[model samples]
Structures are given as C-alpha cells and as structure tokens.
Target chain A: MVSKDELKKLAGLARVELPDSEIDSFRKDIESVLDYVRQIQEVAVGDISEQPQGVYGLMKNRMRTDENPHPGGEFSEEILNQAPQKEGRHFRVKKIL
Target chain B: MSINLEKLTITSAHRHLSNGDFSVEELVGACFKNIEDKNPKLNAFLEVFGDWKEEVKKAQKLFNEGGATELTGIPLAIKDNILIKGKIASAGSKILENYRAVYDATAIAKLKKHQSIFIGRSNMDEFAMGSSTENSAYGPSKNPIDPERVPGGSSGGSAVAVSMGGALASLGSETGGSVRQPAAFCGLLGLKPTYGRISRYGLIALGSSLDQIGPFAKSVADLEIVFNAIKGEDSFDATTLSEPGGLVLPKKLVVGIPRDLLSNPGINQEVIENFEKSVEKLTDLGFEIRDISLPNAAHSLAVYYIIMPAEVSSNLARFDGVRYGFHKTGDDLIDEYVKTRSSGFGREPRRRIILGTYVLSTGYYDAFYNKANLMRNLIIADFEKVFESGVHLVATPTTPTEAFKLGEKANDPLAMYMSDLLTAPANVAGIPAISIPSGFSKNNLPLGLQFIAPAFREDVLFSASRKFLDE
Candidate 1:
C-alpha cells in the first residue's frame, strides 16, 4: 500500500496541491483505488508471453512513403493567423528553454 | 405541408428532398426554428454557428446543381470535442472555454464534402470524463423526453439533440458507453464503430486506442448512411482502415447471449423483458439464438477504469496550459503549470488524471497499467473464442436501467461508472457495437438493446440491427 507521505510526494510531482482538510479523504480514496489495483498483482503466471496478442498486438508501423514531403513555405499566412499567440514569423511561447 | 423536420428520419428527408417536395432551405430553417424553441430547455447546444445562413444557401445550391450527396443539406449537431473550424470545441471544460478549432476533424471534413449542414456544437461531460453530462463545466443537459431526467452522457447533448428533434442526426464520440448508453436513454440509434474504423484526427484525444467517433440518429438506416459517408482511410489518421466497401449479410446469423453477465440486481425488470422479447422476435425470424458465457464480462468495468485513466493521464498531459487552453501566467514556469491545471480542469478530470498518473507511475506501472493491458488481451481473446464458435452477433442491454432522475447517481462516481458496465467490453475489445431503441420502459422511457460483432463485421451488425428495428 502507498503511504500518505508517498501520496503527498506524488501530488507534488503531478503539481497538484491538496487541501489539508481533504488530504485524509484523498488518502482513503487513493488507498481504496490502490487496493483494487493490488488484486491484479496476486495472479500467478508461469511463462509470460512477450508478443502481445489481440488489439494491442495489431499495432503496425504506419509510416507513409507515397506522399511527397511539402516545404515549410507552403503554409499560408492566413493559416498562421489562427494561432492563439504568434510572434512575427512563428507561433509564440513563454520562455521555457 | 409544414412538418417537424427534427422528427423526420434522414431516409424520409431524402425522399422529400428528391421529390422536390421540400427545399434544403426549408429543412435547414425548420431545424434552426426547432433549436431556437427547444434549446433553452434542453441545453443541448453550446454554440449555434453564426454562418448557418450561408451554409444553408450553399447546401441549397448543391441540391439544385444535382450534385447532392446522401446526407446533402441535412443538419446535424457535433459533440464539442470534435473540431469544426472556427467553432468553440470546449469539450465542456472551462479550460477550453475559448478554444477554437483551426481545422475540421476528418469526420467533419467528410460531412462538409457531402455539403451537410452543421447546426451547432453540443454539450458533453468536461473533457468527456463522466457518465452524466452533469460533470460538464457549463451545465447539465436535460433529457428531451423527460426534462427532469438526465440524458445519459458524456454524449448527452448529441443524443438529446436527435431525440428532441433539434437535429436530424448528431455526431458523438464514445470512449466507454458514452454513445450507446445516452442513445439508449434518448431513444435514438447510436453506433460505436470498431476502433480505427473512423479517423480521430482533429478530435481532442480522450483515450487514444479506445476513442471512436460515431453518429446518433432516429433510425438504423440513417446511422448506416452517416457511417458509410464518414468511414474511410484518411492521410492524417494512419490508424483508419481502408474502406472495405458495402458489407453483405449472411443467410443465417447465430446470436450470442451472455445471460449470466446481464443478471445484475440493479438492472430493471422491464429492460430484461424487452431484451428477451427482442431475442424471441429474432429467433422467430429464423436467426439462431445461443446461450453463451462471458464470465470475464463482470471484470470489464474494473479493467476499463484502470486502462482508461492511464491513457487519460497521458493524453491530457498536453494541456499543461503552456500551448493552448487556460493558462495562468504565473511568476515562473512551475507556478504557471501548477496553477493552470489545478484551476482549469474539473473535479472528475482532476481525480481521473491523478489516479491515472499514479497507476502509470514507475513503481505502480507493472502492477496496474501492465496488468490491465494483459487482462484487456484476455477479454479480446474471450470475444475471439466466442466468434470462433460461429456467433455472428452478441446481444445485451445497452444499459442496466433507463434514465434516472437528474443528480441521482452524480455524487457516487462508482455508481455512475457502473452504468457503462455492459457497453465498455466491446470498446475494450475494439469491435463494432450499436444500440437501437428496443421498447419503452415501465416509466415510459426508452430501452435499448446493444448488438456487437467482431472487428470489421459492421455489415453483420447493421443487417441484424435493421432486422431488429423492422421486427
């Protein structure tokens, strides 16, 4: 089971701040959810299969070579005008780099 | 002859349009009139498009030019999550209250190509996260049949729009039972085609592998028409399968029934009786009815809760408020990201996101996400084994019960989640499933029976559904 401190650490990692009053409620909820998940861990398996079967196994490489690559110049100014925030020639963003 | 355009099925509208009995303008005008009259009470629409007059003119011109497609000039509502250029695609979240789509979704592009008239954008649970539209940050969509009752959601608005005659048909996306359950509640036909059958490009991601865009209509035939038009390979969505052409029905179909799985205590007696009657009608029509056991069916909801939230955590990670949507310009980068998501997303979205993040976290990944995926494989294998037994179609109640009163199950998330128990397994297995109006409940509300077919066997599903509707 995940401890309350571990849960708090997870909340910090996810950038969410739980209120002091609701922390206990959230702890119970998270513990119950984790308990439900722990049911999955109890199942015993001998030789685990590597290649996934069914829908997940149906994943195929979806690359396309038939279409020619278009140049960046093809994008119209009218198209660029739709951005929520744009600099002079490019889509603008806050300083993260 | 002035008829309620909202009440008329697409097939009837097509007949009238072809006979020159009614012009496209008249039809579009009637729908707009219906929306103006009904939307205030129903709250089905988020925003009615401003350029509808020009769109109506274009559709009329296309009809006059003899270039009208099957859905030409037909007015439809779109679920807010599917992008339609220049319209607010909020997905019922305050975070994206002002977000406008720069491009049309692939499905919307197809509809536009056919000159279909778009009426408006419909409401949904915030970010398509909840079973009840009550979770919508805007407001809950009231049931058209009974205003005091809920229109089962997150596709509640789309279903109500079709049910209440606001639009001839509407587009809705299904992650779990979003389409079928609401369609059942509203007495409309809803189809959740096999995953990847319709392109998801431009659709705000919910659960990537599980999400599918579908149609809600008054009849099985109308659903087929819209499905045929929007279904095909798209360059933007590589997952879409090539159009396999029209599917033909077999001489005799074997219908599978997981009777034990459906014997839930919460299920209404009337729903069970109606399902049995429908099965009997199918049997009388020479279709073979076989009792089958899908014991693992009970575990579908548990499996879905684990897998879906994990995907939700990943898909919604993009909405950190840096690129688009609600962004709080804080003192620093960390503050901005933290403040934005904390205030932007609703309670349900936050709860699921946190739960999802926890499940996919390093120490918990193998125990939760990985096990869920393995169980998902087992569920698919179960369906494959049933199909191998020569079962052409599987039948179950679309929902356990009819529409409950508004706010009845809203507080208990687990109770609301249980409502999708019958519908989620098909999604987990990635198969074609549909819900058609079965009969009225004891309260006079509608009941729906869902029929599912193996992957790429939409033809069989359609044929069987048509038969059931005819019977």
Candidate 2:
C-alpha cells in the first residue's frame, strides 16, 4: 500500500489539491489502481517500444522550406482573449519564485 | 412533429431536404421539438446552439441554389470537447464552464465545408475521463433507451442525441471507448477511426495519443459518410495521415473471436450470450467465425490505464489557470495551480492525473510507465499477428455489460475503468473499431457488437458492419 506522504507528494506533483477528507480515499484508490497496473511489470521488456499512435507515433516528421503563407498570429487576439488573466497581449499569472 | 425524426437517419434527412418534401427549417424545427421534449429528461445536450436556424437558412439557400452535398442541411450534435470557434465549449467541466472556443476543430471545419448544420454541443464526462457521463460537472446524461440508466460516456450525450433524435447524427471523441461504449449503450452506431485517420487538431486534449474524433449514427452507412467527411490529413495536427488508407474487403468475411478473453469472469452472462448470438448471426450470414488468441489482450486494460493517465497528466498540464479556464487567487504560482486544478477538474480526472503523476515520477517511471508502453507494443504485436494471419476483423462485446444505473460505477474508479476494457485494445493498437447495436440485455438496456479492423482499415470495418446491419 502507498503511504499518505507518497499520495501527498503525487498530488503536489500533479498540481491537484487533495482535500484532507479525500486523501485517505485517494490513497486507497491509487493503491488499487497501482496494484492493477502492476501486472505490466511481469511482462518481459524486449526490443519493442511504442507510443500511443493516436497521440504521437503515427505522425512522421514532415520537413518543408520555411515560408510564411499564414502567419501564426492570425488567432493571436482570439486566443489571448481566452486567457483568464491577460495583460494587453500576454497572459498574466502569479509570480514563479 | 409529423416528420418523426426518431426514424429519420442522416441519409434520409438529406434525401428529404433535396427532394423538397420538407424544408431544412422544418427538419431543424422537428429536431428542436424533439430536443425540447426529450432533452429535459435525458440531459443529452449541454447547449443547443441558439442560432441554428441561421445555419439552416443557409442550407435552405444552398438547396435552392442546387449545390448541396449529402450532409448539406443535416443537423449534427458535436461532443463538447470539440471546438466551434466563439462557442462556449466547456467540455462538461466546471473549470472550462465559461471558456469559449477560439477556433473550430478541424473535424468541425471539415463538416462545415460540407455544410453540416451544427445542432449543439453534447455533455460528456469531464475532460472525457469517465466511462459513463456520470462525471460531467454539468450532470450525467441519462440513456434515452433507459432513462434510469447512464448513457455510456464520455460521449454519452452525443450517442443519446442521435439515439433520442435530437440530431440526425453526432460526433464524439474517444480515448478508450468514449465513443464506442456510449454508442453501444444508447443503441447507436459509433466508430473510432484509426488513431490519425481523423485529425485531433481542435479536440480538448484528454489522452492526446489515444484520442480520436469519431461519429455516431443510426446506421453504419451514415457512420461511413461522417467518417469520410471528417477524416484526412490536417497540417494543424501532425499526427494525421495525408489520406486515409484504402480498405479491401476480404473475399470471405473471417471474424476472429478471442474465446479465452471472452470467458473472463468480469463479463456479464447476458453480454456473453448476446455476443454469441451476434457470432451466430454472422455465421448465419455465411461469415466464417474463427477462434483466435490474443495472449496480451487481457492486459490491454492495464496498459491503457497506465498510458492513458500518463498522457492525460501531460495533456492536461496546459490548463494551469494562466490562459483561459477557471482561475483562483492564490499566494503563489504553486498554490494557484493546485487550487485551480483542484477546483477545475472533477474527482475522476484528478484521480487519473494523480495516478499519472505517480507513475511518471522518478523511481516508479520504469516500473510502471515504461513497462506499460512495452506491454502496449506487445499488445499491438498481438493484433498484428492475428490480423496478418487470416482474420479480416476481430469481434467483441463493446462493453462487458449493458448500461448500469446512473450511479452504479460512479464512485469506483476501477469498475468505471472496466467499462472500457473491450474497447481499449483498438485504441492501444491504433486500429479502427465500430460498435453497432446488437440487441437488448435482460434488463432491456442496449448491448453493442464491436468490430476491430487492422490499422486504417475503415473500409473493411464499414463493409463488415454494413453487411451485419443488412443481415
């Protein structure tokens, strides 16, 4: 079973705030899920490796001469408008340090 | 009301629109009426675009001008995850509750070129996380077939929209059975095209590598039409193929059945019976049914859970409250991200995100994430070996069972994960799969018959599914 500290660390890394009430439940959920997925460890790792095709593998790198037919900024204004906190042309956020 | 849209498939709706038997306005009106009547109880639609009549008027003009495609005036429901520029696309999450799309998804753009009228965005599991739509921040979309039961989800609303006649057809994205399982539950035809067969340019990223936008229709033929319209290469999505690969129907339809996997204790008895009946039906149609073994097929769910969450963790990291989505004030950046995500994402997505982060963390990465991918390669090889031998298509029950009651598996993440067991292998292997209504379960809920064809072999899937439907 995973310890509470490990779950807390995971929540922090995942950037999700696990409420105290739910931390215990999540710990159990994660434990069961981890136990289920633990079977992957038993499978022999050979030369084969893959990335999910729908996400990445099927896409081949297509090289082309750099030409600006349609500039990237076409939807810049629209995209910026979606920002929760924006300053003029940029998205505003809390301080990093 | 006189048109009886519940029986009107997209093809017939197009025929009526072309023949002038009914105007596009009347068809649109009929659909709206159905939505008004059924949507209140079913909760299928998140928002029915208010200006749909304007688009219908444009379609009417096109019909009058004599330049209209088969989908010209057809009203279709789009899953909330897909973007329609300037429309509120919440993706059934509270975080994006007020978020508006800046651009149309590539699939939506393709459909627009064919003049398919946008009906509305349907409800989905928040960020397409749950097997059932129960996790929707909006509310669970009830199955139109049986209101007390869930419309199998994350695309539950899309399936229900078509099943309930709110739209002629609908589109849903699937990262592990989001489309197919719901299509099965709602008794509609749902297809998950080969991974890159349809571009994922504008889809709300869930598990990016596993996500594919597919269509739900009343029939396989209609599903094929929608697939053709939405599929093809898109420069915006580097994953898409330049063109869909051609499919050659085998001289004789040989359907492979994995008996070992089917006999697993997790599957319901009635579902197994229904699967057998479907196999017998194929046999009666003179399609050779052969027992095939996929040694790693049982492990697909495990592999899927690992990879899907890892991808989900990475893909969803974009919604950190800086650019768009729900934001909360915090003392610092760390607190802001945590607070925003904690509030924005629902329980299911958070659970998966945490699981994903755990697996991808140092020390655990090789034991879980890397091992899962290696097993994924093995699973893909398993399918390749079977298909390369003689099987034109592999068959399974789309889900282990029919639609459960609204809250049946809501709290148990593992149970919900099991709902996609049969459907995940196709996504993992990057193959095309479809779920067509097989029959009703003992409880009178819908059951789906799933067919998975080798990579990019949608033609074979269509041909085989069409034949099954006709028989």
Candidate 3:
C-alpha cells in the first residue's frame, strides 16, 4: 500500500497541493492502481530480444529533405490575436529566467 | 428520400452527392436536427461548432460545382480533445473549460480538404483518462440503446453520436480501448489504426506513444473511406510510416483466438458464448481459426495503467495556469498554477497525474516505469510470435460485458479499468484493432467482437471486418 507521505511527495512533484481530506483517499486510489499494475510483473519476458520501440524508428529512415516553407499556409495574424498573452507577434508566457 | 440518407454509408453518400439527389446543407441540417433532439438525453456534444452553417454552405457549393472530394459534405463529429481552430477543445476538463484551440489537428485538416461538415465536439473523460465518460467534468454520456447504461468511453460521446445517427461519422482518438470499447457499447464500427498511421499534430496529448486518431462509423465501408482520407505521412508527425508496403490479405487468413484469455472469470458468460458463435461462423466461412496462447496477455491492463499515467503526468505538465486554460487568480504565478490545477482538473485526472508523477519520481522510475516498458516489449513479442505462426488476425470480445448501467462502475475506478483489460493489449502492442457490432446480448444491447491485426496491417482488419459485416 502507498503511504500518506509518499502521496504527499507525489503531489509535490506534480505541483498540486491536495487538501488534508484528499491525501488519504489519493493514497488508497493510487495504491489500487499500482496493485493492478503489479500483474505485469508476472509476465515472463525471457525470449524477447528487441525492445518495443515506438513509431519513430519505423519512419526515421523515411525522412524527406524538402522542407516546404509553408506546407499548409501560414497562420493569419488574426489567429495569433487569440493568444492569452501576446508580445508583438509571438505568444508571451511567464518569466523562466 | 427512400435511402434514409441519415443511414447511408460514406460510399452511398458520395454517390448521392455526385447524382445531386441531396445537397450538403440538407445533410448538415439533418445531423443538427438529430443532435438537437437526441443530445439532451445522450449528453454527447459539449459544444456544437458555431461555423457549421457557413461550412455547410461552402460544402454545398463545392458539391454543386461537381468537384466533390472523398468525404465532401459528410457530417462528422470530432472528439473534444482534437483541435479545430477557434473552438473549445476541452477534452472534458474544467481546466480547459475556456481554452480555445488555435489550430486544427492534422486529421481535421485532411477532413477539411474533403469538405466534411463539422457538426460538433463530443465529450470525453478528462484528458482522455477514463474508460467511462463518467469521468467527464461535463457529465456522463448515456448509451443510446439503453439510457440507463453508459455509452463506454472516453470516446463515449462520439460512439453515441454515430449510434443514434447524430453525425454520419466521428473521429475518436484511442490510447487504450477508448474508441473500440465505446464503439462496441454503442454498436458502431470503431477502428484504432496502427499508431502513427494518422498524424497527431494537434490532438491533445494523452499517452503520446499509444494515442491514435481513428474513425467511428455505422458501417465498415464508411470506416475505410474515413481512414483512407485521413491517413498518409505528415511532416508535422515524423512517426507516421510512408503508407505501409502491402495492402492485400493473404489467401488463407489465420485468425488467432486466445481461448485462455477469454476464459477469465471477469468475462461475462453471454459475451463468451457469443465469441464462440462468432468463431464457429468464421470457421464455416473458409477462414482458419486456431487457439493461440498469449500467456502474458493478462498483464496488459496493469502495464497500460503504468505507462499511460506516466505519459499523462509528463504531458499535462504544460497546463500550468499561467500559460493556457482556466486560471485561478492568485498573487503569484506559482500559487496560481497550484490553485488552478487543484480546482480545475477533476478527481480522476488529478489522481492519475499524481500517480504518474510518483511512478516517474527519482527512486521509483526503474521499478515502475522502466519495468512496465520492459513488459510492454514482451507483450509485443508475444504478438510477434503468434504472427510468425501465420496468424493474420486475433479476435476477442471488445468488452467482457455489454454496456452496464450508467452509475454501475462510476464509483469504482478499478472495476471500470477492468472493462478495458481485453482492449488494452492491442494498444500496448501498437497494433491496429477494430470493434464491429457482433450480436446483441439477451437484453438486445449491442456486443462487439474485436479484430486485431499486426502493426500497419489495417487493410487486413478492414477486409476481415468487412467480411464479418457482409456475413
């Protein structure tokens, strides 16, 4: 079972502050989910040679050299106007510096 | 009028459009009428597209000019997570309650090229996280067949829309049985194409590696049309293969049946009986059916929960209130991020995000995330071994049971997750799977038989599914 302290640490990592009441519930909920995942440990993987890579490897060699300057056409300024915060032409966000 | 144009397949609709029997505007109006009358009970659409009238007008003009594209004038619904420029793509999350999409998903762009009419956006589990649409912040979608039951989700609304004839077809994204399970419940054809077959350029990320954009239709032929229209390589999505090499099915198709997997206690007796009947029918129709062993198949749901939530935690990191979505006003940005997400995301999303974060944390990554990936490779290898044995397709019941009552599994997330056990294997293996309406339960609710083909072998699935439909 997942402990309350572990749940709190997970919440911290996720950057969400849970209420006092929710911590216990979340611990139980998460533990149940993990218990379900414990079943995967039983699957024997003795003969598998190649790791399950995603589609990236399958299509990596098929790359195209021709980069169309604008394949589907440029986004209109009106579209950019919809951004929550805009500075000149680009979307603005919180300071990371 | 004799054709019940609402029920017409994509092929038939194209013929009618070419013959000038009906216009795109008329068809769009019919879809709107259906949504108006049925959406209230089904809770299918969160928001209908405002520009549908103008879109319909453009499609009608294009059709009249005799230069109609493949899906031209076809009314289609889009799952809420896929961006459709200048519309809300909330993914049924309150966090994105006011967020508007700034661009169209690549699939939507392809549909636009064909002049397909956008009817509305369908509801889903928040951030595509849950099996039942009950997780939607908006509310649950009731199965059209039986209002008391769930329409099986996160693509529940899309399935219901097509099942009840609200939209001619819909585009639904599946990470783990989202599309197929719901389609099975609603008695429509839902195909989860091979990962990367369709670009995920503007689809809201769920599990990036597993998520695939696919179509929901009343018939198999319609599914093929939509699949063909939306598939092809896109510069935006580098993962898409250059349209897989071969398209034809082998003369003697070998279908694998994991008899032991289906014999689990969790499977409903009626569903098992129906599956047996389906295998019998297939055997009589000249296709070879063999019992195959996938000993590790039971581990699929567990593996999926780990990998999907891990991806969810990473993907959702972008939704810090300062950038986009519903922001809970606060003195500082950090506080704002915490407050907004805490209140914005529903319980399930928060639970998953937290769980995912824990699994990927410093000390636990190897034991949880890495091990899950290793097991995923083994599951894919299991399929490979079966395929080497000449099994072109694998078949099973999409869900162990037909649509259960709306609130039956709502409170129990584990019970709900178990519903996806049979379907998750295909997603984890990255193979193409289609759920077609098999037969009805004793109560007359639809049951779907799932057909899974090897990666990039959608053509084989289409052929087998089409044959099943014909029979």
- lDDT of each model, Cα atoms only? 0.84, 0.88, 0.85
* Candidate 1 lDDT by residue in tens digits, A1-97: 6667777776667776565776776766656656655665555433445456655566566876767777766754645555546677675657776
Judged by DockQ cut-offs, the docking class of candidate 1 is acceptable
Better of 1 and 2 by TM-score: 2
Tell me each candidate's TM-score: 0.94, 0.97, 0.94
Residue B89 in model 2: lDDT:
90
Which regions of candidate 2 fall more than 4 Å away from where they truly are?
A45-58, A69-74, B244-246
lDDT of 2 by residue, B22-103 (tens): 9989988888999999999999999989987778888899999988998998989999999999899998999999999888
* Clash list (residue pairs), candidate 1: none
Give a tens-digit lDDT track for model 1, residues B325-361: 7777676777777788878888787777778888889
Which stretches of model 1 miss by more than 4 angstroms?
A1-3, A21-25, A28-52, A66-86, A90-97, B243-248
Docking quality tier of model 2: medium
Which candidate leads the pack in DockQ? 2
What DockQ does model 3 achieve?
0.47
- Better model by lDDT: candidate 2 vs candidate 3: 2
Against the hidden true structure, what lDDT does model 1 obtain? 0.84
Q: Local error of candidate 3 at B112, Å?
A: 0.7
